[model samples]
Target: MEVLGTIISVIGLIVHIIQKVNQSSHGDTNTTYYTDTTYAVVHKFTPQEKLDNMNIDSLNICYKTAGISGFSIEKARRTLLNSYVQHDFYIDDVIIRQNCMYIKVMHAIPFNGGNKCYGASFSMNFMTVNDGVAVYGSKKINADEELVFKEIANELIKAVS
Candidate 1:
Protein backbone atom coordinates (compact mmCIF):
# COMPACT_ATOMS: atom_id res chain seq x y z
CA MET A 1 0.00 0.00 0.00
CA GLU A 2 2.78 2.39 0.87
CA VAL A 3 4.56 1.62 -2.36
CA LEU A 4 1.42 2.24 -4.36
CA GLY A 5 0.94 5.59 -2.65
CA THR A 6 4.51 6.58 -3.44
CA ILE A 7 4.08 5.59 -7.04
CA ILE A 8 0.95 7.64 -7.37
CA SER A 9 2.64 10.63 -5.80
CA VAL A 10 5.60 10.32 -8.17
CA ILE A 11 3.28 10.20 -11.16
CA GLY A 12 1.46 13.27 -9.96
CA LEU A 13 4.74 15.13 -9.54
CA ILE A 14 5.80 14.29 -13.06
CA VAL A 15 2.53 15.59 -14.44
CA HIS A 16 2.84 18.80 -12.41
CA ILE A 17 6.37 19.35 -13.71
CA ILE A 18 5.25 18.89 -17.27
CA GLN A 19 2.44 21.35 -16.83
CA LYS A 20 4.78 23.88 -15.31
CA VAL A 21 7.19 23.57 -18.20
CA ASN A 22 4.42 24.03 -20.72
CA GLN A 23 3.12 27.08 -18.88
CA SER A 24 6.58 28.64 -18.74
CA SER A 25 7.16 27.94 -22.39
CA HIS A 26 3.99 29.85 -23.17
CA GLY A 27 5.20 32.91 -21.20
CA ASP A 28 3.64 31.70 -17.96
CA THR A 29 0.25 33.28 -18.45
CA ASN A 30 -1.70 32.23 -15.43
CA THR A 31 -4.44 34.83 -15.47
CA THR A 32 -7.44 35.12 -17.76
CA TYR A 33 -8.75 38.65 -18.04
CA TYR A 34 -11.99 40.09 -19.35
CA THR A 35 -12.03 43.16 -21.57
CA ASP A 36 -9.49 45.91 -20.93
CA THR A 37 -8.30 44.70 -17.58
CA THR A 38 -5.02 43.79 -15.95
CA TYR A 39 -4.29 40.87 -13.61
CA ALA A 40 -1.14 40.45 -11.62
CA VAL A 41 0.11 37.45 -9.66
CA VAL A 42 1.72 38.92 -6.62
CA HIS A 43 4.11 36.51 -4.88
CA LYS A 44 3.82 37.77 -1.39
CA PHE A 45 3.63 35.30 1.50
CA THR A 46 2.10 37.00 4.48
CA PRO A 47 1.30 33.78 6.37
CA GLN A 48 4.42 31.86 5.53
CA GLU A 49 5.22 30.67 9.05
CA LYS A 50 1.60 29.94 9.87
CA LEU A 51 0.87 28.15 6.62
CA ASP A 52 4.05 26.11 6.97
CA ASN A 53 2.57 24.66 10.15
CA MET A 54 -0.24 23.19 8.07
CA ASN A 55 2.19 21.74 5.47
CA ILE A 56 1.17 24.31 2.86
CA ASP A 57 3.82 26.70 1.52
CA SER A 58 3.14 27.72 -2.07
CA LEU A 59 2.43 31.43 -2.37
CA ASN A 60 -0.21 32.25 -5.00
CA ILE A 61 -1.92 35.64 -5.14
CA CYS A 62 -4.06 37.39 -7.71
CA TYR A 63 -5.19 41.00 -8.00
CA LYS A 64 -8.01 42.09 -10.26
CA THR A 65 -9.84 45.40 -10.35
CA ALA A 66 -12.14 44.94 -13.29
CA GLY A 67 -15.91 45.19 -13.13
CA ILE A 68 -15.77 46.36 -9.54
CA SER A 69 -17.81 49.47 -8.97
CA GLY A 70 -19.13 50.81 -5.69
CA PHE A 71 -17.22 48.21 -3.73
CA SER A 72 -17.99 47.66 -0.07
CA ILE A 73 -15.42 45.92 2.10
CA GLU A 74 -17.90 44.62 4.61
CA LYS A 75 -20.11 43.16 1.91
CA ALA A 76 -17.12 41.42 0.34
CA ARG A 77 -16.18 39.88 3.63
CA ARG A 78 -19.66 38.52 4.25
CA THR A 79 -19.88 37.24 0.72
CA LEU A 80 -16.55 35.43 1.03
CA LEU A 81 -17.64 33.76 4.26
CA ASN A 82 -20.88 32.65 2.66
CA SER A 83 -19.09 31.47 -0.45
CA TYR A 84 -16.65 29.40 1.57
CA VAL A 85 -19.42 27.59 3.37
CA GLN A 86 -21.42 27.07 0.20
CA HIS A 87 -18.34 25.68 -1.56
CA ASP A 88 -17.89 22.97 1.11
CA PHE A 89 -14.69 24.39 2.52
CA TYR A 90 -14.11 23.93 6.23
CA ILE A 91 -13.35 27.27 7.78
CA ASP A 92 -10.44 26.96 10.17
CA ASP A 93 -10.25 30.53 11.35
CA VAL A 94 -10.83 34.14 10.34
CA ILE A 95 -9.26 37.39 11.43
CA ILE A 96 -10.84 40.72 10.61
CA ARG A 97 -8.50 43.66 10.62
CA GLN A 98 -9.11 47.29 9.81
CA ASN A 99 -9.55 46.80 6.05
CA CYS A 100 -8.74 43.15 5.52
CA MET A 101 -10.24 39.79 6.38
CA TYR A 102 -7.89 36.81 6.68
CA ILE A 103 -9.27 33.32 6.33
CA LYS A 104 -7.93 29.79 6.72
CA VAL A 105 -9.76 26.96 5.07
CA MET A 106 -9.36 23.24 4.48
CA HIS A 107 -10.93 21.00 1.90
CA ALA A 108 -11.07 17.22 2.01
CA ILE A 109 -10.92 15.07 -1.05
CA PRO A 110 -11.75 11.36 -0.87
CA PHE A 111 -9.05 9.17 -2.32
CA ASN A 112 -7.75 5.60 -2.40
CA GLY A 113 -11.04 3.83 -3.02
CA GLY A 114 -12.79 6.29 -0.75
CA ASN A 115 -11.07 4.92 2.31
CA LYS A 116 -8.48 7.65 2.70
CA CYS A 117 -8.90 11.37 2.28
CA TYR A 118 -6.44 13.99 1.09
CA GLY A 119 -6.84 17.50 2.32
CA ALA A 120 -5.34 20.89 1.47
CA SER A 121 -5.19 23.98 3.64
CA PHE A 122 -5.50 27.45 2.17
CA SER A 123 -4.67 30.86 3.62
CA MET A 124 -6.32 33.82 1.96
CA ASN A 125 -7.08 37.49 2.43
CA PHE A 126 -9.77 39.81 1.15
CA MET A 127 -8.76 43.42 1.30
CA THR A 128 -9.80 46.77 -0.09
CA VAL A 129 -7.48 47.75 -2.91
CA ASN A 130 -7.11 51.15 -4.50
CA ASP A 131 -9.20 50.29 -7.53
CA GLY A 132 -11.39 47.68 -5.85
CA VAL A 133 -11.34 44.68 -3.55
CA ALA A 134 -8.57 42.11 -3.98
CA VAL A 135 -8.47 38.43 -3.20
CA TYR A 136 -5.12 36.94 -2.28
CA GLY A 137 -4.64 33.26 -1.58
CA SER A 138 -1.86 30.75 -0.97
CA LYS A 139 -1.84 26.98 -0.77
CA LYS A 140 0.75 24.25 -1.24
CA ILE A 141 -0.99 21.55 -3.18
CA ASN A 142 0.16 18.73 -5.40
CA ALA A 143 -1.51 17.50 -8.54
CA ASP A 144 -4.05 15.58 -6.48
CA GLU A 145 -5.19 18.70 -4.67
CA GLU A 146 -7.78 21.04 -6.07
CA LEU A 147 -6.59 24.57 -6.87
CA VAL A 148 -8.86 27.18 -5.27
CA PHE A 149 -7.17 30.39 -6.40
CA LYS A 150 -9.47 30.95 -9.35
CA GLU A 151 -12.55 30.17 -7.33
CA ILE A 152 -11.56 32.59 -4.60
CA ALA A 153 -10.83 35.35 -7.09
CA ASN A 154 -14.09 34.79 -8.92
CA GLU A 155 -16.05 34.81 -5.67
CA LEU A 156 -14.43 38.04 -4.58
CA ILE A 157 -15.13 39.66 -7.93
CA LYS A 158 -18.73 38.58 -7.70
CA ALA A 159 -19.01 40.07 -4.25
CA VAL A 160 -17.53 43.38 -5.30
CA SER A 161 -19.53 43.54 -8.49
Candidate 2:
Protein backbone atom coordinates (compact mmCIF):
# COMPACT_ATOMS: atom_id res chain seq x y z
CA MET A 1 0.00 0.00 0.00
CA GLU A 2 2.93 2.32 0.56
CA VAL A 3 4.28 2.22 -2.92
CA LEU A 4 1.99 3.51 -5.56
CA GLY A 5 3.37 2.68 -9.02
CA THR A 6 5.41 5.33 -10.77
CA ILE A 7 5.82 5.95 -14.48
CA ILE A 8 8.12 8.37 -16.24
CA SER A 9 8.29 9.61 -19.76
CA VAL A 10 11.98 10.25 -20.03
CA ILE A 11 12.48 13.35 -22.13
CA GLY A 12 15.78 12.44 -23.68
CA LEU A 13 14.44 10.32 -26.51
CA ILE A 14 11.15 10.90 -28.33
CA VAL A 15 9.78 10.89 -31.85
CA HIS A 16 7.03 13.52 -31.93
CA ILE A 17 7.78 17.16 -32.24
CA ILE A 18 5.57 19.50 -30.19
CA GLN A 19 4.76 22.32 -32.55
CA LYS A 20 6.79 25.05 -30.87
CA VAL A 21 4.20 27.74 -30.82
CA ASN A 22 4.99 30.77 -28.76
CA GLN A 23 2.73 30.35 -25.77
CA SER A 24 3.01 33.98 -24.64
CA SER A 25 2.01 35.35 -28.00
CA HIS A 26 -1.16 33.31 -28.04
CA GLY A 27 -3.05 36.19 -26.38
CA ASP A 28 -4.71 36.39 -22.95
CA THR A 29 -6.04 32.86 -22.77
CA ASN A 30 -2.73 31.04 -22.52
CA THR A 31 -0.87 33.81 -20.74
CA THR A 32 -1.57 32.22 -17.38
CA TYR A 33 0.25 29.12 -18.45
CA TYR A 34 3.27 31.09 -19.58
CA THR A 35 3.71 33.45 -16.67
CA ASP A 36 7.38 33.61 -15.68
CA THR A 37 6.71 34.22 -12.03
CA THR A 38 5.59 31.61 -9.56
CA TYR A 39 2.24 31.74 -7.83
CA ALA A 40 1.05 30.30 -4.55
CA VAL A 41 -1.33 27.40 -4.71
CA VAL A 42 -4.42 28.97 -3.21
CA HIS A 43 -7.43 27.14 -4.53
CA LYS A 44 -8.70 23.99 -6.15
CA PHE A 45 -9.31 24.15 -9.86
CA THR A 46 -12.92 23.39 -10.59
CA PRO A 47 -13.70 20.41 -12.81
CA GLN A 48 -14.44 22.77 -15.64
CA GLU A 49 -11.49 25.10 -15.12
CA LYS A 50 -9.10 22.20 -14.90
CA LEU A 51 -9.43 21.41 -18.59
CA ASP A 52 -9.51 25.04 -19.55
CA ASN A 53 -8.83 25.84 -23.16
CA MET A 54 -5.20 26.54 -22.40
CA ASN A 55 -4.20 23.10 -21.14
CA ILE A 56 -6.48 21.28 -23.54
CA ASP A 57 -5.13 23.17 -26.51
CA SER A 58 -1.56 22.53 -25.49
CA LEU A 59 -2.15 18.87 -24.80
CA ASN A 60 -4.10 18.48 -28.00
CA ILE A 61 -1.28 19.94 -30.02
CA CYS A 62 1.06 17.43 -28.46
CA TYR A 63 -1.24 14.50 -29.13
CA LYS A 64 -1.87 15.61 -32.64
CA THR A 65 1.80 16.08 -33.36
CA ALA A 66 2.49 12.64 -31.99
CA GLY A 67 -0.09 11.04 -34.26
CA ILE A 68 -1.78 9.48 -31.29
CA SER A 69 -5.34 8.22 -31.53
CA GLY A 70 -7.92 6.95 -29.06
CA PHE A 71 -6.53 9.04 -26.24
CA SER A 72 -8.54 11.95 -25.00
CA ILE A 73 -6.75 15.00 -23.68
CA GLU A 74 -10.07 15.81 -22.07
CA LYS A 75 -9.89 12.63 -20.03
CA ALA A 76 -6.22 13.09 -19.26
CA ARG A 77 -6.97 16.62 -18.24
CA ARG A 78 -9.53 15.52 -15.67
CA THR A 79 -7.25 12.84 -14.25
CA LEU A 80 -4.24 15.15 -13.91
CA LEU A 81 -6.36 17.91 -12.44
CA ASN A 82 -7.61 15.55 -9.81
CA SER A 83 -4.05 15.03 -8.59
CA TYR A 84 -4.17 18.55 -7.25
CA VAL A 85 -7.81 19.12 -6.36
CA GLN A 86 -7.98 15.79 -4.59
CA HIS A 87 -4.66 15.85 -2.80
CA ASP A 88 -4.44 14.74 0.85
CA PHE A 89 -1.82 16.95 2.54
CA TYR A 90 -0.82 20.10 0.71
CA ILE A 91 1.20 21.16 -2.27
CA ASP A 92 2.32 24.77 -1.98
CA ASP A 93 3.58 25.97 -5.33
CA VAL A 94 1.69 26.46 -8.54
CA ILE A 95 4.78 25.37 -10.50
CA ILE A 96 5.03 22.12 -8.60
CA ARG A 97 1.35 21.60 -9.10
CA GLN A 98 1.84 21.99 -12.81
CA ASN A 99 4.72 19.52 -12.75
CA CYS A 100 2.52 17.18 -10.80
CA MET A 101 -0.02 17.27 -13.58
CA TYR A 102 2.44 16.48 -16.37
CA ILE A 103 4.27 13.92 -14.29
CA LYS A 104 1.06 12.10 -13.57
CA VAL A 105 0.17 12.08 -17.21
CA MET A 106 3.60 10.76 -18.15
CA HIS A 107 3.56 8.14 -15.45
CA ALA A 108 -0.02 7.01 -15.67
CA ILE A 109 -0.27 7.03 -19.44
CA PRO A 110 -3.93 7.50 -18.66
CA PHE A 111 -4.74 7.97 -22.23
CA ASN A 112 -5.31 4.87 -24.43
CA GLY A 113 -1.51 4.85 -24.41
CA GLY A 114 1.30 7.34 -24.03
CA ASN A 115 4.52 7.84 -25.92
CA LYS A 116 7.99 9.24 -25.41
CA CYS A 117 6.74 12.22 -27.36
CA TYR A 118 3.96 12.96 -24.91
CA GLY A 119 6.25 12.74 -21.94
CA ALA A 120 8.91 14.90 -23.54
CA SER A 121 6.44 17.52 -24.65
CA PHE A 122 4.55 17.67 -21.38
CA SER A 123 7.63 17.92 -19.18
CA MET A 124 9.33 20.37 -21.50
CA ASN A 125 6.24 22.52 -21.54
CA PHE A 126 5.87 22.25 -17.80
CA MET A 127 9.41 23.48 -17.32
CA THR A 128 8.96 26.24 -19.85
CA VAL A 129 5.65 27.23 -18.35
CA ASN A 130 7.32 27.80 -15.05
CA ASP A 131 10.10 30.19 -15.96
CA GLY A 132 12.17 27.35 -17.35
CA VAL A 133 12.48 25.99 -13.84
CA ALA A 134 15.02 23.40 -12.78
CA VAL A 135 15.97 23.30 -16.40
CA TYR A 136 18.97 25.54 -16.66
CA GLY A 137 22.07 26.83 -14.90
CA SER A 138 22.56 23.79 -12.70
CA LYS A 139 19.13 23.89 -11.12
CA LYS A 140 17.85 21.03 -13.18
CA ILE A 141 16.30 17.97 -11.61
CA ASN A 142 17.67 14.79 -13.06
CA ALA A 143 15.87 11.48 -13.26
CA ASP A 144 17.64 8.63 -11.56
CA GLU A 145 17.41 5.60 -13.78
CA GLU A 146 18.66 3.65 -10.77
CA LEU A 147 15.72 4.48 -8.57
CA VAL A 148 13.03 1.87 -8.14
CA PHE A 149 9.42 2.68 -8.93
CA LYS A 150 8.58 3.12 -5.26
CA GLU A 151 11.57 5.37 -4.72
CA ILE A 152 10.69 7.46 -7.68
CA ALA A 153 7.16 7.80 -6.39
CA ASN A 154 8.50 8.89 -3.04
CA GLU A 155 10.73 11.45 -4.70
CA LEU A 156 7.78 12.81 -6.58
CA ILE A 157 5.77 12.89 -3.39
CA LYS A 158 8.53 14.75 -1.59
CA ALA A 159 8.84 17.13 -4.50
CA VAL A 160 5.26 18.32 -4.21
CA SER A 161 5.00 17.93 -0.45
How well is each residue in 73-125 modelled by candidate 1, as lDDT tens digits? Answer: 56766666665443434455554556655556554442223322333333334
Query: Candidate 1's C-alpha lDDT?
Result: 0.52
Give the Cα-based TM-score of candidate 1 against the true structure.
Answer: 0.41
Poorest stretch of ten by lDDT in candidate 1: 110-119
lDDT of each: 0.52, 0.31
Clashing pairs in 1: none
User: Which runs of model 1 end up more than 4 angstroms from their true locations?
Assistant: 1-60, 63-67, 82-85, 90-92, 110-130, 139-141, 144-146
* lDDT comparing candidate 2 with the true structure: 0.31
